[model samples]
Target: MYNRLTLATLASLPKTITRPRYAREALRPGILHIGVGNFHRAHQAVYLNDLFNAGKSHDWALIGAGIRPADRAMRQALEAQDWLTTVVELEPGANTAQVIGSMMGFVPVGEDARAIVNALDDPNLRIVSLTVTEGGYCIDPATGSFNPEHSDIVYDASHLDAPRGVFGALVAALRRRREWGLAPFTVMSCDNIPHNGSVTRDAVAGLAALVDPELAAFVHGSVAFPNSMVDRITPITTDRERTMLTERFGIEDKRPVFCEPFRQWVIEDNFPTGRPALEDVGVTFTPHVAAFELMKLRILNGGHAAIAYPAGLLGIHFVHDAIANPLVRGFLDKLETEEIIPQVPPVPGVDLHDYYRLIASRFANPDVGDTIPRLAQDGSNRQPKFILPVTRDRLESGADVTGLALETALWCRYCAGTTDEGEPFRLDDPNAARLTPAALAAKDDPAVFLNLRDTFGDLADAPQFCSRFGIALKSLWREGTRATLQRYLNDGF
Candidate 1:
């Protein structure tokens, strides 16, 4: 039996639950990680925990920081346990539990980012890492570039001293560093954006330019934003997971992360100041993280987008269940093989088809318990990143976008916020309020949703794209999600 997990209970805990091998008290802070969520904890923290176990980079521990008020709950949960997190690695046959203590501290979330600003001033903090999701970057969907005119950017530019956003916090930190004559630390983005490094550099430099051109020049020159490709199948923590820990594993861990056995991190080896020796712990440091990024984003992420919306509309709850449906799985396979994969460039040492095969197997893993809701959330943000890029590639190449166009129309029907049975499932998204209205209007006028030119651009006006999309939307409403999917699978387009 195991009691609630805390540093004090480390001695009595079962040996099966892997504990940190190094001395926790001696571990010092080095990286300040923003957005300490499930993916970050499962993937990045696990790697650091491995390095700490290997007795390397003792000073390279993480100090978790949060900008959103919602993060306080995570802070309280972790701080209550002395910054320890229980990570359960879910494999095919068995699961393993491990306690990670690489994060020794946290910067409290607040309206003004002063706490994080002050934390960054410390010379020991050599890298500011973030996993703030793709939406957090504030890139305009019309163009794959940073949106400097975002309301947050405008607010931060004026209230630089009392800023609230991530870029605001970054600007404050760099300004402090420059005034104190400290060399600027590297900014590493672990998000799933194409050219995430360039996006980070653009957001920071763009905001800094508004504040001060000289400061912008300093930021543009001094900072090193390295692009990376990180992968792991981590699901939302459910009561089932908690019970599994308490009953099967004989441990009580609040907010424990459960993830797949596999993990991969491919990073561009560029940190001007310094970084963790993560390469020692199965992290691939390479120059062409872009290639890896494109491969993962298009093949894996696009695959998720392909199945996610239709799955949600069909009321499929779990990822495995969604992919298990013959129609859903067939749609994913046909779309990728016929339309998506051909546009992806050849990556070094990676067979694109083999990657797709790996993704297929990964999607079929039931132990991970990845939810369709998680994959389907934030369609306004996710579709642009995961699905639209492939559509654009096919469009540019003059390939038949019939499958891609149908996929977009399926997304349009999904946005209408109802299933074939007219059952109302809440559309969970940041833009749900606006998106729902546009989607509802599109029910009457098949092309109304396309007018949101910022997202669809001129493709909403293109005869081929719009016609296919309109047909798919009409069929989706008239027939149902399953019949529509079956039609597309049968090449009824």
Candidate 2:
């Protein structure tokens, strides 16, 4: 008989799925992960579990923490099953599943984050890793800087005793770390931003500076925020996945994450308080992580944003189908080759073209079940980091930004509250309320959207980009998404 997934029921799991061989009771908490999402469970947690399974890094067990109301539900689900997650690796034909036990437990998710701050204050917690998505950084979409004016940032700044956000938790904990004469933990960002480590450092330091200038100095000088490039095509869990686990795997897992079998992690080696032997796993630690970060951001992440708007407007639901569409796929290949890759510097050992090939193949894997909405979500945060940088580089180098500008225009059109098929769908973005009005206004006048100095910067005033963006926006409104995509596909704007 199938049993619900738990440490107590590990031996009862079906033979196909791999369960942890090591004892969970022996694992000591060493890392504090902020977000317990699919990507974190699939990527970071998987790597640590691999290290633990090899009978190494037993002390580096992850203590999961969250700073949101949604995290409370996640905590409830996981706590019922001993914080174990069933990760199903979806390959083309052969499938593999595993029960990950790297997380010891979830910290309380509430307004008062003293529990979280106390956990971070612990000397044993040498590393504070985050997978809180690109938007979770609380970045101002227009300026690409941390938004100190954000409500959460404002609240956390004023209330030092009981901070609510992750940055606040870190700041409060660091205040104690400095006061108690303890070394600050390494803060590693596993998010998908360009120069993610440096971006994280800016956010943390900027927040700390507002809270206390002296504490800010100590945090700025003491903490090591490592930049990292993390990749895995992990999709959100759904009722479909839960059903699959029950029918095929004979395990009643409350939370099961399904993703592509392929995974990669490239990290900058900057851990100050000491780190686990993750290099023994597949993680590549390098002094120069910028090259890898830029390559992945501009190529893989940029390509995702490139296809998402068009695919969503065209009424395509899944990512594999979107890339399989000749128009969408062609647009991605051309945009990356002609516009994006040229702006990227070469990594020491990796071929750019081979990387593109790998990314395209991964997108084409139907089993991954990555959705267009998942990719298309949070375009405000995504476009600036992933697409706009490449566009800016091309513009400065005097290269044509027709394809890139068109991509941005497609984004504007996508934000206009309806798809090309005249069907309405919810645009899940933090800035959607303001964005929709601006986008709708942009349909008549492209300058309306471009005028947002925070988002477009001086790109709107640049004659070439301004003219091309106007043309593309007009064309998308007059002709349609498909025609515009096909026009770019044929190398014409």
Candidate 3:
């Protein structure tokens, strides 16, 4: 019989399972991390757990905090187990489970940022990290810049004390710290956005600029926002995973995370106060992390976007299944090899083509069980960050974007709320209200979808892109996803 996973039962877990070798009682909170989602638990928390296991950085334990309502559910679940998480690494041959003890505590969840802001005000907290998804940075999707005019930014700026979003809470906390003569905490972003640290700095300092220009200046000058590239194919937790944990390891973890065996972290070494010795555990810390970050955003994340829509429209459930299909796999292979890789600049110590091969192999891991739906969600946010930049780069360099255009057309078609087989599925984007109507309209008038200025930006106005996008979208509606993919593969647009 399985026992409930808690600090009480942690020592009794199966001998085959690996867990923290250190004492949780010895851990001290030095970092307050926002958005404690599956990826954070799998990637950042895992690295810290390794660091602590090596008998170092005990004071840098993570204090998980979040501003979203979903975080409340996460807090409740983890609180039931004394803030512990069971992470299962799935390999083709065998899987393993571990109870990560990196997170020492979780902040109470609420709409207003009071609780999170209060957590940030702690003097012991030297670094305030975030995994608040790509869209959470208050960025203008079209411009790829900080949007001070965002409603959340406006709310947080005026209501500094009872801020409504992450940036507001950060502003409030930093302003208070500056007044108290305390140094501003380092703001490290683990999101997938290009130049994530700079983007985060823009959001936080930009919000501060609205309330107090002096505070904005202080935030800009004092805080360190280090760029980092984090990789792990962590799928959402389900009952299947819970059962596997119970059956295989005799542990009934409420929120067990299942991910692939591969994990990578390349961080820019810019922390002013201090950081854990993650390097000892295999994290690459360098003076320049831009090349690594760009390579990942373009190759790995961009590959996910490339395959997501076609798989979703074909009713392929699992990511590996999509990759296993000859047509889908062919589409991804051709697109990355031709259009995507050429646009990527050379990294310091990496070969772009080899990196693409590794990404494809990872995507094809059946044990990972990553769903097409998870990847296909939030295109409005993802497309801008992943696909469009490459498109813009190709267009600037006077190269044809046939594969890029097809990828975008596939996205537009996916937003139409049905598969090729007439199966209706919910459009999962936050902009569904806008996207659905536009997608439906695009079936008749392809330009209608491109008019989403916030998403397509001036790319909609580019005659070449518009022409290819129009032809690709019409072809999909006329010939269907598979045929359209096959046609693109056989002949160039």
- Estimate every model's Cα lDDT from 0 to 1: 0.88, 0.89, 0.92
lDDT of 3 at 325: 96
The candidate maximizing TM-score is 3
Give TM per candidate.
Answer: 0.98, 0.98, 0.99
lDDT of 2 by residue, 314-390 (tens): 99999999998998988899988989888889899999999999999999998888999999898888888898888
Name every residue pair that clashes in candidate 1: none
Worst 10 residues of 2 by lDDT: 452-461
Q: Which lDDT value does model 3 have at 154?
A: 92
Tens digits of per-residue lDDT for model 3, 214-256: 9989988899999888999999888888888899889998888
Candidate 2 achieves a global lDDT of 0.89
Better of 1 and 3 by lDDT: 3
In terms of lDDT, the poorest run of 10 residues in model 3 is 115-124
